[model samples]
Target: MKEIFEYRALLIELVKRDIKKKYRRSILGILWSMLNPFFTMLIIAMVFSSFFKFAIKNFPVYLLTGQLIFNFYSEATNTAMGSILENASLIKKVYVPKHIFPIARVLSSGVNFILSLPGLVLVILITKAPVKFPIVFSFVPVLYVLFFCFGVGLLLASITVYFRDMFHLYGVLLTAISYLTPLFYPKEIVPEKYMFLIKLNPMVYFVDLFRDMVYYGKMPTLDEHLNCIFIIIISLFVGVVVFNMNKKKFILHI
Candidate 1:
C-alpha cells in the first residue's frame, strides 16, 4: 500500500495515458464510452426482449445493470492482460514495479466504468424503476468488483508475459463467460440442473449483488455478500502469489 501511495503520480499518469490513447483519434471521444453500452443495451432490449418475451419488468434496466458490471470486468482484465507487453519499452528501460502497469490499466477502465453510470441512471429513470436512497450504497459492490478485476488482471498480465497465447485464449473465454452469466435473462428461467453452474461463477455473484441494490432496490442476501467476499479474497491471494512468482522472469519473455 505504501509503495503504491509513493508511486501514485506514475499510476495517475499511466491511467491518463490509457484513457487518452483510447480516444485520441475519435471525434466523439469519451462520449463513446457511455454510448457504447447504451446502444448495446438498446439493441439487446429491442431484439431479445421481443423475441424471448422476458417476463421481467423494465428489462432494459436489468440488461444495462448487468452489462455495466460485466463490461467493466471484461475491459479492465483484457487491457491489463496486455499491460506488460504493451509497455515493453518501459519494462526494459525502467525499474518501476511491474505490477503497477496492470493496476493502471484496470484503474483506467474503472474510470470509464464510473463515467458510464449516468447512462444506467438515465435508463432507470426512463423505465421508472423504483429508486431508493439506499441505491447510493451500490458503490460497495462496485468496489468489490473493482478489487476482483484488479486481482484477476494482475494474474493475467503476469501470465501473458510467458504465454502469449493467453491473449487469444482469454478472448474466447470471455465470450463463454458472458454467456454463462445471466445477463439477458433471469435466474428463475435457468433450468434447475444447471443452476449450480451459475452459482459457481464468481461474476454472477458480483452482478447479482449489483442488481439487488440498483435494479431490484433491495439489499443483497448474506450468502450473496459472503460469496463475493470469498471470491475477492481468493482472487487477490492467488493473483499476488502468481505475479510475484513470475514477475522476475517477465523481462526474458517480454
Candidate 2:
C-alpha cells in the first residue's frame, strides 16, 4: 500500500496524459468521449429498431447500458495492447512498476465512463424509465467489473510487451466476444440449448446486471453476481502471476 501511494502521482500523470492524447487535436476535444459512445448507441438503436424491428422501447437506454460496460472492456484492452510498447522510451529511462502502465490505461477508461454518466441520467430522465431498486445495489457489480478490467489489462499489457502479434489478435477477439456476449441482443433470443454457453463468457453477466439495474428495473440473481466475482478473481490471479513473472523483461524487450 505504501509503495502504491508513492507511485500514485505517476499513475495519475499517465492517466492524465492518456486522456489528453485521446482527444488532442480533435475539434470536439473531450466532448468526443461523450459523443462517441452516445452516437454509436444511437446508430445501433436505430438499426435494431427499424431494420430488425425489435419491439423494445427506449432501446437507446438498453443499448447504452451495454455500450458503457463493453466500452470499458474495449478501451482498457485496446489501450493496454500497446501500453509498454508506446512507452518504451520512458520505461527504459526510468525505474517504475511496469504494472502502472496498464493500471493507468484502465484509469483513463474509468474517467471516460464517469463522464458518460450524465448522458445516462439524461436518457433515463427523458425516457422516464423507472429506476430499479437494484440501482441502489449496483455498486457491488461495478467493483467486480473494475477488478476484471484491471486483471485483464495486466495480462494483456505483459503479453503485448513480448508478443507483438497479440495486439492484432486481441482486436479480433474483442469483436468476436462483443457479439458473442449478447451486447446487442437479449439472452432469451438465444436457443435454450446454447444458453449455458453464453453465461460462461463472464461478460454476459456484467451486461445482464447492468441491464437489469438500468433497463429492466430489477436485481439480477445472486448467481449472476457470483459469476462476475469468479471472473475477477481468476483473471486477476492470472494477470498478477504473468505480470510479476514477465514485468522484469519489459524494459529489456521494449
Candidate 3:
C-alpha cells in the first residue's frame, strides 16, 4: 500500500503524458476521441436500424452508451497489457510499481470516457429518453465498472509481460466477446439454448447494467448487479496474485 502511495505522483504524470501524447499532433486533437466512437455508432446504427426494420429509437444514444463504455474497457486492457514492453527503457531507470503503468492506461481511458458523456446527454435529449433520477444518482454502477476495468487491466498487464502471444489473443477475444455480450442487440435476440452461455460471461452483466441505467432508465435485476460485483472482486483478487508473483521478473524480462 505504501509503495502504491509513493508512486501516486508518477502515476498522475504518466496518465497526463498518455492523454497528451495520444492527441499531440492531430488537427482535430482530442476531438478525434469523441468523433471515433460517434462515427462507429453511426455506422452500426445505420446497419442494424435498417436491417431489422425495428425502430431504433434514439439509435445514436443507444449505441453510443454501450459503445463508448465498452470501448473504454477494451482499449484500456489492450493498450495497458504492453506497458512493460512499451516502456522497456524506463523499466530500469527508476524504482516504481510496474502495475502503475497499466493502471495509468485505465485512468487515461476513463478521463476520455467521462469527457464523452456530454455527447451522450445530447443524444439522450434528442432521442427523448427519460431524464430520470437514477441517471443522475447512480454512481454505484460507475464504481463497479471502474473496479471491473482495473481488475481486468491488472490481469492483462501481468500476462502480456510473460506471454507476448497474449496480446494477439486479446484482439480475438474482443471480437468474439462483443457479439456474445449484448451491446447493439438485446438479450432476447440470443437463442434460448445459448442464453445460458451469455449469462455465464461476467461482462454481459456490466453491459446490461449500463444499458438499464442509461438507455432503459431502469435499474438492473438485483441478481445481475450482485453477480457483476462478485466477478470484479474475484478478477481483481486474481490479478493481484498474478501481478505480485510476476513483478520481480518484469524488470528482468523488459
Best model number under lDDT: 1
* TM-score per candidate, chains pooled: 0.97, 0.93, 0.94
Cα lDDT tens digits, model 2, 34-131, are 77887888788777856434556677787788888888878887897678788888888878877888888988988887787777777788778788
Q: Which ten residues in a row have the lowest lDDT in candidate 3?
A: 50-59
For each candidate in the order shown, give its overall lDDT on alpha carbons: 0.91, 0.81, 0.79
TM-score leaderboard ranking: 1, 3, 2
**Which candidate achieves the best TM-score against the true structure?**
1
lDDT of 1 by residue, 28-111 (tens): 999888899999999999988875564777889889999999999999999999999999999899798889999999999999
* TM-score-better candidate, 2 vs 3: 3
Cα error, residue 73 of model 1, in Å, equals 0.2
- Model 3: lDDT to the true structure: 0.79
Model 3: what TM-score?
A: 0.94
After superposing candidate 2, which stretches have Cα over 4 Å from the reference? 51-55
- Which of 1 and 2 is the better model by lDDT? 1
RMSD of 1: 1.1
